[model samples]
Target: MSDAEVWTFNVDDYAAKLQCPTLIIHGERSDGFEAAAQHVFRKVPAQNKKLIIVDGVFHTRFYDDPLVIEPTATEVAKWFKDNVK
Candidate 1:
């Protein structure tokens, strides 16, 4: 968890190195999250990568809210179906 802190380290290098089918899902209302998510989405090298913006939700809430999580789960499942063998 300590290694994941943005203040301590950066992932842009790793983001640029991604070679797998990537799925980027984030909520619509986060203050600075959308831009960061888009930045990572742009860096992914995978041809089959996707960026999904979930509606009526915000960053942390997307993880816990049933209303938001269910639909987001559907999108995740679809991404796996289309990208995974």
Candidate 2:
């Protein structure tokens, strides 16, 4: 098995053990790691689950694009407010 395959397996297993509320934000242009994000998001059993797909955003755009970052932060804040105590 390759290193990437091993990493994927470990990440999926880790995600399956998460029980807290989860907010998954994915860059639509990031084809590389989107499947991993989706696997993690689906594993989380949150009453309030959020998956925000920022269009036209690349993998690293979250650090550079205000347009994507702002909305992601807003949604995450809302998810926390709605779920967390």
Best by TM-score: 1
Clash pairs detected, candidate 1: none
- Deviating ranges (above 4 Å) for candidate 1: 1-6
Candidate 2 lDDT over 1-85, as tens digits, reads 8988876766666667667767778887897777767777887765557777777788888898788778878888887888889
Query: TM-score for each prediction?
Result: 0.87, 0.73
Candidate 2 Cα deviation (angstroms), residue 48: 4.1
Q: Compared with the true structure, what per-residue lDDT tens digits does model 1 show for residues 1-85?
A: 5655767666788889999898888887887688899998999988888999877578887778898888888888987988899
In candidate 1, position 44 carries an lDDT of 90
> Scored by CA lDDT, what does every candidate get?
0.84, 0.77
What TM-score would candidate 1 get against the native?
0.87
**RMSD to the hidden true structure, all candidates:** 1.8, 3.9
Give the clashing pairs for model 2.
Answer: none
Ten-residue stretch with the least lDDT total in model 2: 7-16
Q: Which runs in model 2 stand beyond 4 Å of their true positions?
A: 1-9, 45-48
